[model samples]
Each structure stands twice: as structure tokens, then as C-alpha cells.
Target chain A: MSTFVGLYNYWIVIVLMMAGLYTVIAKGNLVKKVIGLNLFQTSVILFYVGMGKVEGGTAPILVHGDGAEEVVYSNPLPHVLMLTAIVVGIATTAVALALVVRLNEAYDSIEEDEILEQDPTT
Target chain B: MIAENLPVLPIVLPILAAPLCVILHRPRLAWPLAVAVAWATFGVCCALLARVLADGTISYQLGNWAPPFGIEFRVDSLNAWLMPLVSGVGALVLTYAPRSLAAEVARSRHGLLYGVYLLSMTGLLGMTVTGDAFNVFVFLEISSLSTYALVSMGPDRRSLMAGFRYLIMGAIGGTFFLIGVGLLYMKTGTLNMADLAERLPAVKDSRTVLAGLGFLATGLSLKIALFPLHLWLPSAYTFAPSAVTAFLAATATKVSVYIVLRFFFTIAGVGESLGNGAVREAIMLLALVGIFVASLVACFQQEVKRALAYSSVAQIGYILVGVTMLTVDGMTGALVHVFNHALMKGGLFMVLGCVVARVGGSRLSDLRGIGRRMPLTAIAFVIGGLGMIGVPATVGFVSKWYLVLGALEAGLWHVAAMMLVSSLLAVVYVWRVVEVMYFQEPEDAPEIDEAKTDEAPFGMLLPTLVMIGATIWFGLDTDLTVDVARRTAAMLLGGGS
Candidate 1:
């Protein structure tokens, strides 16, 4: 029970990852699939943020002075990396949505099955 | 100063030019700018490869920020070989693109297309140069997103569907890679690849590391389009503008293969805690299956581009099989194929592009009597086909020679036999196109003009022939590609880190 509680953040991560994966695989609507991908990416972001948190740690602001005591601060690198990842995620979403919009204009529908029915080769 | 900045130049030049292209606002201006920058990047790559060959590995800190803390651009013989191939292919295809894009993409959007093409090339080159794990994901998305846009620029609605599918799958692959990098960082507290390599061994036994490896392998396999994960590739190749197809077929998947080599052999040092034999055996099994299945599938494709796209999947299998051997000769074979496959496949796609430009379609039926109508282009296709079949005196034969030698060195007789048989499968598909082009009469091919010779324009033909010429040149002169590949294989197996 202690171990379960201790790893609760990880458990949430796994659950979210699975839900996202399932939605991506099962959803036929292209927009819903993009949302699924967002969920999938959000889980990874959560994982990074969770891993960066230290017990009672503060932000990684450097202190200066003769009396400045050593403070336990959370690792900032993962957070910084995920910030780039968030931007990448947004870019990916934008490209995907733009592609979706074009696909809809061409096919008159965003349903994969409907689009494929219209052009079997696709 | 220029020599010192070699490691970053190939990546920096193109990315800097990408925005300049859009700002230029006219393709007449943008196209020339793109070509000049691409050639400059290739020249820089050649110089970098020469330096790496002479001085050993060169590492540059981005903004002079020392690594483990700042991003590093590291170049060894491995990436030195790849950088030239990527930039060289970009140069060739960009030189050939204006006419091709003029036909396929809209006139008003040509400037934007050139911008996106440069961004895609930048992303691939950046992925090749970076020594940081997270940086790989960043560059991968940059390339993948631009690639989706480029594919959608194809004339038909199918291209739109193809591009959308690729975006979805490629995003998933990129995210998986990000998750893998995050896992590694959680355990090691560093993103620098070399630093991660050094620290990984201490935590080698951890479940986190194993999970990271799993994620990395799966994600890279998707990106590389290795066998089962390759569903996005065929249509993506089939429907993209001819120039985009040629550029991507030659470079994109090969870069992913190089990354796999980096992660498994360099960072993880697969001979250690990675269960080398088990992992190698699994890859070997899949590669063998992929070679047989994809080759057979290629034999049935009606569209010439689709046939070659399936053949690309089979060729990737050949590269992976060589990688699994884990011998110097085997890795050498894989590296050589990485170079050789680009020449042959890029040349073949250019040949198809020529046919598409002239005939307006690449279906087998459309190619009837093409040998008579466009003798030079048809003959180029035949030569490219011969290379695919691993015929002697061609680049494909050279790579396969090293591959078979490697398999035999590893005492994998059956794997070597399967490889030989798959080359015969290539003959079937190539023959199908050859027969249609040469033997069948052009009376049925309404698109083929019977009045005068319709060879591809001098600009397109020159690049296509140059690529085909390199195929034969590299095949005969084993001194360059083979020597570099041998040293690279030695370095990789000697723990390249």
C-alpha cells in the first residue's frame, strides 16, 4: 500500500498513456485522433514534470550571499526540455489540424472510413 | 574559422536559408536561393567529412556553451558519411525541383514549397548533427512536420490523405521518442549523448533503462519504417511531388537508420546489458520477413512509384540484416548500403520523376513504349533497376557483396541465402516495368507523343544521370565508401562513444 501510494503519480501516468493510446488507435474522427495524440503527449509532459519534483524542493533559483544556505531544489532540466516539447506538440497539432482541414475540404468529410471509401487507394 | 565551424555549418546554413526563402516571396528568387544554399551545404559536408577522416571526431558546443549543459554538434566518421549524402541529395533534387514542382504544386505556392523543403532538409541535417537526446526529438518534428506539408503539395486529393496519415503516425513516433528520452534523463540526469553513454552502464540493470531502450527501439523502428511499421511510407512516397519523393527516399529513412545505430550501439552499447543476441535475433527475424514480404508485394504494384516504395522497405530490411550481424564487415555493409541505397533509390525516383513530368503519370501502363519515346530516361530506369537487382558492376551489388561476406563471417548461411533470393524478387518488379517500357507498343499509351523525342529536360536529366553515374562510380571504386564504412564499423563496434 505504501509503495502504491508512493508511486501514485506514475500510476496516473500509465493510465493516461493507455487512455491516449486507446483513443488514438480506436477513434475514426481525425480531430478526435489529434486530441488523443495531445492526451498522449500530455502524459509524457506529466511524467517529466513528476520526475523533476523533489520532496519539498523549491524552484531552481540561485541564492547569493555569505549566509546563503544550500537549498534542495528540483531539477530544472527536464522542465526546460518539456517546454521545448510543448512547443513541438503545438506545432505538430497545428500541422495535423491544417492537414485535417485540407483533407476535409477535399473529401467533404473527416471520417477516415468515409474518405477511404471515396478514394480506395488512400 | 570556417574549418572550426564545420560541424554546425551543414545544419545552420539550410535552416538560416529556409526563412529567407519565404521572405523572398517569388519562387524564381527562392528557388535559386535554395539551390545555392543546398550546394553550399553539400560543399561544407564534403569538407567536414574530409576533416573527420583526417583529424578524428569533431565536437562543437552550441553558442560556446560546454556540454552536459549546452547542446553539442558531434561529428564522427559515421555522420560524416551521412551528412554529405543528405546534403548532396538535397542539392541534386533541389536543382531538379523547379520544373517538377512547377508541374505538381500550384504556381503561387512555389515559394512556400521551397521554404518548407529547406526546413525539412534542415531538420534531417540537424538530427544528424545533434549529440543531445531531446534535440533529436526537436529536429525530428521539424523534419516530419515539414515533410507532411511537402507531401500534401502533390496535385491530387490522395496526397492530402497521405500527408494527414503520415502526420498522425509520425507525431506518435516522435512522442514515443520523447518519452524514451525523458525516461533516460530521469535515470541519468543528462541529455548529452556521450555523457548518457558514460553514465548508462552504472544504471544498466534498471527497469527504467530497459523501458527506455524499448521505447527508443519502437519509436525509431516506426520512423525508419522497418517492415510492419512502414504503412505510412508507400502512399506518402507515391503521392508526394516527384522531387520530394526523390529527396526523401534517398535521405529521410536512412537518417533514422543512422539514429538507430547511434542509440543502440553508441549510447546503450548493446553488447552490455542490452541482451545483444536476443535483440539481434529479433531484428534479423523481422528483417528477413520484411525482405521477402515487401519484395513480393513490390512485384504486384501497378504504380511505378508504389513499386519502388515497397522496394525501399525491402532495401531497409537489407540494411537492418547487415546491422544485426554486429561484425565490422556487417556494419560496414549496412553503412555502405546507407550510402549506396541513396544513390540507386534517388536515381530511380528521379528517373520516375522524369517519366511523370513527360508522361504525367507513373503507372506501368503509362510507360508503354517509353524506351522508344524517351530513350535516355528509360535507359536510366533500366540501369537503376539493375542496381536494385544487385547486378555486378552496380552499387547495389557492392553493398550486397559486403553484406553476404558479413553474414558468412557470422556463419549465417540461411540469412545470406534469403538475401540472394530477395534480390531475384527485385528482378521480377524491375522486369515488369522494363517489359512495359520497351517491349509493349506505344499505340495504347495515349499520353506518349509519337511525333518527336520527349526526353526529360536537360536540368532534370543531368541530376538523374549524375546520380546513376555515382551508382556505377561508387560500385567500382570501393576505396572511398567501403574504406570509410570499414573504419566506421570498427569504431562503432569498438564502442563508438
Candidate 2:
């Protein structure tokens, strides 16, 4: 029970990841697939953020001038890395959504089944 | 001073220049700028490779920040060899792109296309040069996102569908890589690959490490389009504009294969879990199956470009087979084929680009009697096809020789037999195209004047001829390609430089 409690955030991440992957695989709607992709990426962000949290820690700041005191701080690097990851997620989502827009214009529908019916060689 | 900055220059030059094309929005100005940047980057890459051969591994600290903290650009024998190939192909494609782009892409969007091309090259070069694990993910997405846009720029509406599918698959693959990197970081608290390699051995037996390895392998295999994960590749390559196909067929997946080698051999050490038993057998089996299945499928394609796209999948199988063997000779074969396949495949796609420009379609019937109509282009295609079939005195034969030797050295006689059978399948596909082009009568042969030869423009034909010439030149003289591959493989398995 203690182990389960300790890894609860990881468990949540796994659940969200599987849900996103399932939606991506099962759904034929392109928009919904994009949403699923975002969900999958967001779960990774959550994993990193959760892993960076410390038991008894504050923001990673150095109190230097006069009141310098030793402080336990959460790791900040993972959060910083997650910021880059977030930007990449947005770029990928943008390209994917743009492709969806063009695909809709070309196929007259965003549904994969409808698009395939229109004689896409793929 | 310039020599000190060579490692980062290949990536930096184009990335900085990419946005300029978008900002200028002048196609004429943009094309020249992109060409100059590509050739300049190629020169830098060549210089860097020479420097590495003479001196050793060069690691450049970004902003003078140390490792395990800030990012670094690392060049060893392996990546130093690859950098030139990426930029060299970029330079040649840019030279061949003008007439081809005008034919397929719209006039207004040429600037945007060149910008994306440079961005893709920058991303591929960044993946080759960077030492940071997170940096690889960043560059992978950069390349992948641009690649989707490039594919979608094709005149065919189906290209949009193909691009969307590639985008979806690529996102999943990249996110998987990110998760793997994150897991590695969680266990070790470092994103530097060298540092990760040093620390990974301590937790090699941990479930976290195993899970990380699993995720990384699956993610990279998706990117490499290995067998079952290759659903996105054939359509993407077939539907993309011919120039984009030529550039990407030469470079993109090869970079992904490089990443697999870097992670498994360099960072992860390929020891207990990765090197033996199920993982090795699974990859080897997939590669062998991929070779036979994709080659057999290639024999049936109606569209010539689609057939070559399937053939690309089969060639990737040969490269992976060499990699999975884990012997120096095997690795040499893999690396050598990476160079050879890029030359032959890039050259063949350029031939198709010429055919599509002249003949207006890439179907088998469309190319009927092309040998008599466009004799020069047809001859180039035949020579490239012969290279693909592993004919003697061609680069393909050189790599295949090394591969069979590697298999025999590993005492895998059946694998050697399987490889030979697959080469025969290559013969069938090449014969199909040859028969269509050379043997069949052109539907409009009599309507046109028989004396006048309708060849592709000199600009496109020259690049195709150069690629074909290099194919023969490198085949006869194994000094440059085989030597570097041998040294790189030796360095990798003897523990990475």
C-alpha cells in the first residue's frame, strides 16, 4: 500500500499515456487523434514535473545578500527540460493541426474512413 | 579560429539561414542563399572529418558550459563521417531542386519550401553533432515536423494524407524517445550521453534501465521504419515531391539508424540485456523478414516510385542486419551500405524526378520506350538499377560483399543465403522497370520526331550523372568509404571514441 501511494503520480501518468495511445489507435477522427497526441505529450510533462517535486523543498533560489540560509530545494533541471519539451509539443501540434486542415481541404472530410473512400493511394 | 568552430558550423549555418528565406519570401533570392549555405556546410563538414581523422574526437562546449549541464557538440570518427554525407546530399539536391520544384511546387511557395529544406538539414546535422540526449529529441522533432511539411507540399492531394500519417507516427515515435530519455535521466540525473554511458552500468540490471532501453529501441525502430513500424514510410516517400524524396531517401532514415547505433553501442553499452538472446534475435528476425517481404512487395508495385520506396525499406533491412551482427566486419558492412545506399537511392530518385518532369507520370506504362526517347536518362537509370542489383564494379556490390563476408565470419551461413536471395528479388524489380523503359514501344513514338532526344534539363541530368559516377568511382576505389567505415566500426565496438 505504501509503495502504491509512493508511485501514485507515476501510475496516473501510465493511465493517461495508455488512454492517449488507445484514442490515437482506435479513433478515425484526425482532430481527436491530435487531441490524443497532446494528451500523450502532456502525460510526459506530468511525469517530469512529478519527478522533480521534493518531499520538503521550495523553489530553487539562492538567498545570497544578507540572509543566506541553507535550504532544501526541488530539482529544477527536469522542469527546465520540460519547458523545452512543452515548446516542441506545441510545434508538433501546430504542424499536425495544419496538416489536418490541408487534409480536410483535399479530402472534403477529416474522417480517415471518408478520406480513404476518396481514393487515397495509401 | 574557424577550425575550432567546425563541429557546430554544419548545423548552425543552415539553421540560422533557414528563417532568412521565410523572412525574405523571394524565391529567386532564397534559392541562391540556400545553395550557398548548403555547399558551405558541406565544406565545413569535410574539413571537420579531416580534422577528426588527423587529430581525434572534438567536443565543443556550448557557451563554454561544461558537460552533464549545458549542451555540447561532439564529433567522433562515426559522426564525423556522416556529417559530410548529409550536407553533400543536401548540396546536390539543392542544385537539382530549382527546375524540379518549379515543376511540382507552386511558384509562390518556393521560398517556404527551401526554408523547410534547410531546417530539415539543420535538424539532421544537429542530430549527428549533438552529445546531449535531450538535444537529439529536439533535433528529431525539428527534422520530422519539417519533413511532414515537405511531403505535404507535393502536388498530389494524397500527399496531404501521407504527410498527416507520417506526422502522427513521427510524434508518437519522438514522444517515446523523450520518455526513454526522461527515464534515463530519472535514474542517473544526467542528459549527457557519455555521462549516461558511464553511469548506466551501475543500474544496468534495474527495471528502470530495462524499460528505458525498451522504449528507446521501439521509438527508434519507429523512426527507422523497421519492418512492422514502416506503415508510414512507403506512402510518404511515394507521394512526396521527387526532390524531397531524393533528399530524404538519401539522409533522413540513415540519421535515425545512426541514433540507434549511438544509443545501443555507445551509451547503453549493448551488454547483457541488449546484446544477447531475445532482443538481438527479434531485431535480426525483423530485418530478415523485412528484406524478403518488402523486396517481394517491390516486385508488384504499379507505380515506379512506389516500387523504389518499397525497395528503400528492403535496403534498410540489409543495413540493420549488418548492425545486429555486432562484429567489426558486420558494422563496417552496415556503415558502408549506409553510404552506398544513399548514393544509389538518391541517384535513382533523381532519375525518377527527370522522368516525371519529362514523361508527366511515373507509372510503368508512362516510361515505355523511354530508352529510345531519352537515351541519356535511360542509360543513367539502368546503371543505377544495376547498382541496386549489386552488379560488380558498383558501390552496391562493395557493400554487399562486406555484408556476406560479415555473415560468413559470424558463422551465419543461412543469413548469407537469405541476403543473396533478396538480391535476386532486387533483380526482379529492376527488371520490371527496365523492361518497361527499354523493351516496350512508346504509345506516342511515331507522332514525335525520332531524331530529337527529349532529355531532362542539363541541371538535373548533371547531378544524376555525378551521383552515378560516384557510385562507380567509390565501387572501384574503396579507400574513402570502406576505410572510414572500418575505422568507425572498430572505434565503436572497441568502446566509443
Candidate 3:
């Protein structure tokens, strides 16, 4: 039961990760790919956050009411790391959207197969 | 006091300069500012390499926090060698940009291009020096983001599509890498590389650790454009502005190769990573296929720049072949090839920039009378092509020689033979350009006009020639690169003091 509980979240992470990867590889629409990329990144973010959680632990903040009070806090490092990763994910999504916008303008189509069919050069 | 700060300066200076370029957005002023700052970064790299030589490894803890608790910037022989090569290329490419970019990129976009270029440079330098796992992903994304922007800035509309493709592939690569790092952190509870290295061995047998390693390899291989994953490279390189192509070709994938080595040998421990026969043999087989397939694709290219782009993939194969041998000499060859291929390809691409600047296209027919038109640029192209072919007295020869010696060291004769065969194939492709440029008559040249005898302006020609000169000069005396590479290879294989 403990093993099942411990492994369940990771199983979800893998499923979500694979779903994102499959979307990216399977979808023909550029915008869909961007969304897929976001999903992929979000799955990793979840993995990091899930790993940082400590059961029955309080927030990662020290109480100053009593200097001698025993404290139990979940690890805060993964949360800090995810903050940066979230920013990166946002930056990547922004850039991908911007590129898609430009690509749509230039090619008059955002569909990969149509664009290739319309193109001349390999 | 000044020398103590060299480690941090290279990363910080360009980042500071990047925004300054944006605020001071006059194309004329921004470019010179970018060039000056890049040269200063190169100077810092030189000082850093010297310090690493004098003192074994230079480590700086950010905010004076201790390692395992704080981010550290560590400079060992491996990074010491990469530092000068990457920064030197940045300085030279920035110098070459003003002329090479004027024709291909819009005049309005020059300031923004330089700004993105500096950001990319800062990211590359930061990625090289950081001793933390998470920091690598940050810097990788920074560089990848800026590189996509720089590539999209090309005048051709197709550049947008090319850049979009790269963005998708590169982002997937980055996220995969992030997943891998997160797994490592979960297993070890530390982001510091040295800390991870020390702890990974204890849990090396864990399925999680093995999966993490597998993800790391897959992610980096995608980033490095290794073999089957190389679909995004040729179009991206072919369509980017010449200056961006030169910069990315010289540094980006090479740095990706560095990241792979760092993760496998330094962070994961060599015995746990490369000691796996499956992994070693897989990398070798993929590299061999990449070499022959990319070479075959290169042989049939109609455009010179795209041909060299395919050729870059094959050259990357040479580096990987060296790495897979896992011998001292093989690693040395790979390390030196990192620099040698930079000089050779940078020069080759600059020559292509000049040719394209003159004739408006890099098609084979357009190059027919290019030899007579721009003898200097044409000859530099020839010299670079010879280097690519591993002709003696060129930097390419030095690395290939080391690689072959390494193959023989491991009693791998067929691998050595394959190297020779690919090089001969290199001669065929390079010669295709040569015959058209020098031997074919101008009238026989197709599609483009009979080009006038016009030389590339002095600004661009000078830097390209410097690269060509270094290629030949270093090929003869492998003193600086080979010496550093030998030590670096030893250090990477866990033999360094």
C-alpha cells in the first residue's frame, strides 16, 4: 500500500508527460505543438513540486513566537527551483506563440502539412 | 583583486551589455558597443584560462554561500579550454557581423539582433562556468531562446518557419533535460554538480537514476542534433542570417556536447555512465550512421551553405566518435575538434557570407567564376574546405589524427577506416564547390549573372582570414589546443589532479 501510494503520483507524471510528448509529435498544427510543449513543461513542474512535499509538514516558514519551538517544514528548495522553471516555461510559451504568429503571417497557414505542400524548396 | 573576479565577469558583462544595447538602440552605436564588450569577454576568458592553469580549478561561490548550498561557478581544465574557444568566437563573430549582416538582415533589426546575440553569448558563457545542475537548464533556455529569435530575424520569410521548427524541437529538448535534472535532485537532494557527483554513486543502481541518465542523454542528443534527431538543423542553419549561422554553428551544438560530457562523466560518474557497454555502443553506432548519412546528404546539396550545414552534422559525428572511444587520445581529439571545427567552420561560413554578399545566392552555379571575382575569399574557402577534408597542415588534420590514433589504440581498425572514408567523402563534396569556383567558366555558371570582381569589405575579410590563419597555424603546431585538450581529456576521464 505504501509503495502504491508512493508510486501513484509518478505514474500520473509519466502519463501526462507522455501525453504531451505524443501531442507534440502527433499534432500537425503549430499552435497545438506549442500547447503540447506547455503541457510537457507543466508535467515536469508537477514532478518537482510533488517531490518537494513532506506529509503532515507545515509551510516552509520559521515561527518566531518561541525560539525553542520544534519546527517541521517541507523542503522549500524544489519550490524555489520550480519558480525559475515556471518563468522559463512562460518565456518558452511566449516565444513559441510569437514564432507561430510570424509563421502564420508568412506562410498564410499554420498547418504543417499544408505549409510543406505549398513550399518549393526542401 | 581584478583577477579574482574574472570568473564572474565574462557572464555578467555581456548580460549587462545586452540591455545597454537595447537602451542605446542606434544600429551604428549598438554594434560597436556589442563588439567591444565581446572582446572584453574574450579577454576575461583568456585570464580565466590562465588562472585555471596556475591554480588547478577556480571555483567561486555566488553570494559567498558554500557549495551544496549555493550556486558555484567552477572552472576546471575542461571548461578552461571551452572558455577561450566560445568567447573568442563571440568576439570574432560580432566583429564579422556588421558587414556580413548588412545585406541579409534588415537595417532596422541590426540593433535588436546584436542585443539578442549578446544575450546568447552571455548564456553560453554562463552555461559553461556554472557548477550547478539547474543553472545549466536556465542558461540553455536563455541561449536557445535568443538563438531562435536571431534565426527568425533573417530576411527570408522561410526563416520564420525554420525558427519555429527549432523552437519546438529545442523546447522539447529543454523540458526533457529539466525532467532529468529534477529526477537527479529527487534522488540526491542537491543541485550542486560536485555534490551530485559525490552522491550519485550511492544510488547509481536505482531505476530512477538510470531513467534520469537516459533522459539526459536523449535530451542532449536532441539538442546536439545527433543523427536522426538532426532534422531541425539543416533548415535552421541554411535560413538564418550568415552571422547567426556562423555563431550558432561554432558554439551552440559544441556547448551541447559539453553538457553531455559534464552530465555523464562529471555529474554521474564515468563508471556508472559510459561504462555501460550498451550506452557506449549505441552512441558509437549512431555517430557512425550520422557521419555517413549526413556526408551522403551533403554530397548532393545544391546550395553551399546548406552543404556545409550537413557537413557540420558529420563533423559533430567525428567529435562523437572520439567521445565514444572513451580513450585519452579519443577525448583529446574530441576536445580539440571542438575548437578546430569552430575555426574551420567559422571561416568557411564567413567565406560563404562574402560570396552571398557579392552574388546574392550560394548556389553552385553562382560560384562558377567566384574564384576570379574574389580570389581572397575563394582561397579562404578552399583552405577551409581543405581543413574540413582533414588535409594535413589544417586544424581538421590534427583532430582527425588524434581520433585515428585513438581508434588504433583501441584496436578498432574498421572505425579508423570509416574515418578515412568519410574524409575522402569530404574531399568529394568540398571539391564539388572547388571545381565550380575555380575551374568552370563564368558563362557555364547557371542562373546568376557573371559576377563582377568585387572583394568583401576589409572589416569582414580580415576576421575570416584570421580564422583561416589560425586553422592552418594550429594544425601545424597543435601546441596550445592539443596541450589543453590532453589535460582536459585526462581530467574528464577521472584522471586529473
Candidate 4:
């Protein structure tokens, strides 16, 4: 039963990773690429959060008289790390999306190839 | 309070300044504030480096939480050396940005440009000083995102395309790095670098560890723009605003190289049998290819910026070669070159910026006969060009000298020969620019404007000349940089391999 659940979780993560990677590689629009980057980063967060799970575990916070506890606790470190990563990921996406908006305004197009084609120096 | 807070100051000061710059909402105020913040960060880094040098190592736990649990900022001889390089360059670049920003960037957007520049500077410095493995990825993205923004600010439309390409590539690299870090976490159940280094040895031969290493090396190579993977660099540098190009060219990939060194040598445990003779040899071969092919390509470029961009790729090859040698001397060469290349390339690109400001472009043809017009600027360019070509008594020469010696020590005579051949190729590219600027008459020679003949504004020219002077100064008196690099190399090599 546990193996089945674990396998399902892994499958979901694999799909998320593949989806994010595909968008990053295939999308020509700069905004879409940043969205793809966010998606890619999010999948890693999901993977870490998944790994931190302990079946039937309570919060990692230690309570009084909890020595030799009846219930196991989820490892909280990955979740904490993910929180920092999530913040960073958001910052990156924000900055990247901002750049995309500026690029659109500057070049009058968000499409990558259009900008390249219209470049005067090239 | 100061002792407890020192570790986080390098990242926090600039991080806070970014929002402050935005709130101020005026370019004039933002420029001075950013410069002041950058210098403060540089001072903080210097203090941090001095502390690490004196104390051996300093570890700071965020929120007073103990590590393996909380995020850590660990400073040792390795990162202690790098902190100054990143922050010092940040301060120098900001000093030059005020006037250059006025000329190239639109006035309305100036505040935003300086804000992003400050953020990028904060991010790069943070990446170097953070001891948490996952934190490196976070800071990497911080710098990468801002870089795409900064690059897009170039007046030419091509800058948009260049920024776009760089964004795509940088995102892919960042994602790969994330995956690598995730795999390591899955295997070791820890994210702190010191904890991982402690744990990695036990799993040195494990498939998970090997896969993580593979992912990390590929990701970082892309970030460093190593050889064939460097497709986005030339265009990005060529089209980006001159100040932006100079700042990024000087420090960005060098910081990435620092990451590569940290992961491979420190976190991965350099003495692990899994990372043995065969792997080192393969890396060396790739470095050699990068050196020869990139230099040869650089020699034929007509645009001065594009040529320098390719030259940067070749210089990265030299650093990789130093790493591949795996000896103390070799690593020292690589570390010193990291500093030397920053000085020379920063100066060289600033010179190009001056030329761009004066003549309105960076094409080889436009620069013809400008040497007679702008003698000081042209002379500075020549000195920087010669430094790039590794003339004696320049910083570039010191780096190549150590690299050659490193190769010979490893009994790689053929590698040493390749280094010499690549230096000759550098001479070819350097000579192309010199001959154009000095030899050929200006296309419209008769109609000379006296105002244009004067050097760039004192602010712009002063920074360029200072960097040029540093390149020559460090080359002649290598004592300080050499000592720091030697200690850094020893630290990375795990107390003398």
C-alpha cells in the first residue's frame, strides 16, 4: 500500500519536471519561458516537500513530554529549505517577468524570434 | 551586535538597498545610494575576508539556529577570497555607472536600472558567501534574473534578443542545478554544504551522488559559458550597454567558476576515488579544445566587443585548465587568473564603453584613426589589449605564466604548447583592434570635431584608467594576490592534495 502511494507521488513529480522543461525549451515567448522557469523551480520544491514527508507523522515541533513520542514527526528541514527556495524562486520569476514586460515595451514584441529579426546590428 | 551580524551583512546591505533605491524613485539619489551601499558591502567583505584569514573559518547560523537545521553562511579561505572580488567589482562598476547610465539608458528608467544592478550585485556576492548548497541556487537565480533585465536595457534592439537568449539558457542552467541539489538532498537528507561535505564521502560511489555531480557540473559549465556551451555570451555582451557588458564580463562567469570550484573540490570531496584520473583527464581535454578553438574564433571577429566576448571564453578555458591540473600551483593560477581577468576585462570593456560614448559604436571600422583623435582613451585601450594578450608586466601575463608552469608540472607538454598557441591567437585579435584604431585613417578624416577628441567624461575615464593601472600594478607586484590565491587553492585542494 505504501509503495503504491510513493510510486504515485514520484510519477507526479516526473510529469511536473517534464512539463516545466518542455515549456522552457519549446516556448518562444519570453513570458512563457519565465513561467516555465517558475514551473521548473516549483517541481523541485514539490520533490523536496515530498521527500520530507513521513507517513502518519505530526508536525516536527517538539512538545513537552514528547520524549519517545507515540507518533513520528515529518522531517521539517526540507520544508524549511523549500520555504527559502520558494521565496527565491518567486523573486527570480518576478525579476524575469519584469524583464519580459520591459523587453516587450522596448522592442514592441515579446516573441523571441521577432526581436532577433528586427535587430539592426545583426 | 556587529560581530554577530557580520556574516549576513554582505548580502543584507545590498538586498535592503534595492528596495530603498526604488522608493527614492530618482536616478540622482539612487546612483549615490547604490554606490554608497556597494562600497559598504565591499568594506564588509574585506572585513569578512580578514576575519577568515585570521581565524581560519567563520560560520554564522541564520536566526541563531544551529546548522544541518538552519541556513549557514560559512567563510573560509576559499570563499573569503571570492567575497572581495564580487563586492569590490560591484563597487567599481557602480562608480562608473552614473555617467554611463545617463548616456545609454533612458532617463525615466534610470532608477529601475540602478535598482536591478544593485540587486544583481547583491545576488552575486550572496552566492559566494552562502554556505548552504540550496542557497547557492537561490542566489544564482537572483543574479541571473537581474542580469537578463540589465542586458535588455541596451539601447539597441539586439540587446532584447540577447537578453532573451541569455534568459532561456540561464533558466535551463538554473533548473538543472535545482535538480542536482534535489537529488543530493534526497540522498543525504541535508542541504547545508558543510553537512553535505561531511556526508558525501560515505556515498562517493553511489549512483545518486554521481548523478548529482553530473547535473551540477553540466549546469555550472553552462553558467560559466565554458567553450561550446557559450553560444549566448558574444551576442549578449556585444549588444548590451557597455557598462553592463563590462560588469558582467568581468565578474559574472568568474563567480560561476567559483561555484564550480566550490562544488567540485569542496563539497564533492576532491580526493574521492570516483573523481579520479580519468575524469580529470577528460576535463583537461575539453579545456584544451576550448582554449584553442575559442581563441582562433576570437581572432577573426570584426566587432571589438564580440572579439572580447570570445576572448573571455578562451580565458575561461585557462581557468578550467588550472582546475583540471589539480595541483596546488595549478589551482593558484586559476584563482589568480580569476582576479587578473576581472581587472583586464573590466578595463578593456570600459575602454570600449568610452569609445562607444565618443564614436557612437564599437565596430572595428568606426574606431579607425580614432587613436589620433582620442589619444588617452586609445592608449588606455592599447594597454588593456596588450594585457589581454599577456604581455610581460601585465596581470594577464602573470596568470598565463603560472598556467604554463602548472601544465609543465603535470607533464602535459602538449597542453603547455596549446597555451602558447592560444596566446599567439590572442595577439592576433589584439593586433587587429590596435591596427584599426591607429593605422587606418578615419573614413571622414577631414571633418574633425575637437570636442570629440577629448577623453570621455572624467568620471568614465578615471575608472577605466584605474582598472588599467591595477592590471599593470598587480602584474608587477603579485605578492598580495598570489598569497591570497595560494591560500585559497590550498583550501580548495583540501590542505594540499
TM per prediction: 0.98, 0.98, 0.97, 0.93
- C-alpha lDDT of residue B465 in model 4: 91
Per-residue CA lDDT of model 4 for B1-497, tens digit only, reads: 98778989988999899988888879889889998999999899899888888887898988988987778888888878788878887788788887776778788888888888888888898888888888899889889988988898897767877887788788778878877888888888888888888888888789888888888888988899987889889989988889889999989999999898888888887776325888787777887888888888888888899999989998999999998887778888999999999989988999899888878888899898878888988999899888888899999898988888888888888888888878889889999999998889887767777456666888888888998899999999999899989888777776221
Q: lDDT per residue, candidate 3, A1-122, as tens digits?
A: 88877778878888898999899999999999989889999999889888998887678987778752677788999989999999999999999899888878888899988788877663
Instruction: lDDT for model 4, please.
Output: 0.85
What digit string (tens of lDDT, one per residue) describes model 1 on residues B70-112?
9999998888889999999999999999888777888888898
In model 3, which residue pairs have backbone atoms overlapping below 3 Å? none
Tens digit per residue, CA lDDT, model 2, B322-361? 9888778888999999999999999999999999988888
Q: Given candidate 1, what's the lDDT at residue B232? A: 97
- Docking outcome class, model 3: medium
CA error at residue B138 for candidate 2, angstroms: 0.6
Q: Which pairs of residues collide in candidate 1?
A: none
Q: Of the pair 2 and 4, which is ahead by lDDT?
A: 2
Off by over 4 Å in 1: A64-67, B273-275, B444-451
Q: Give the local distance difference test score of model 3.
A: 0.89
Stretches of candidate 2 off by over 4 Å are: A64-70
Between candidates 1 and 4, the TM-score winner:
1
Q: Worst lDDT window (10 residues) for model 1 chain A?
A: A63-72
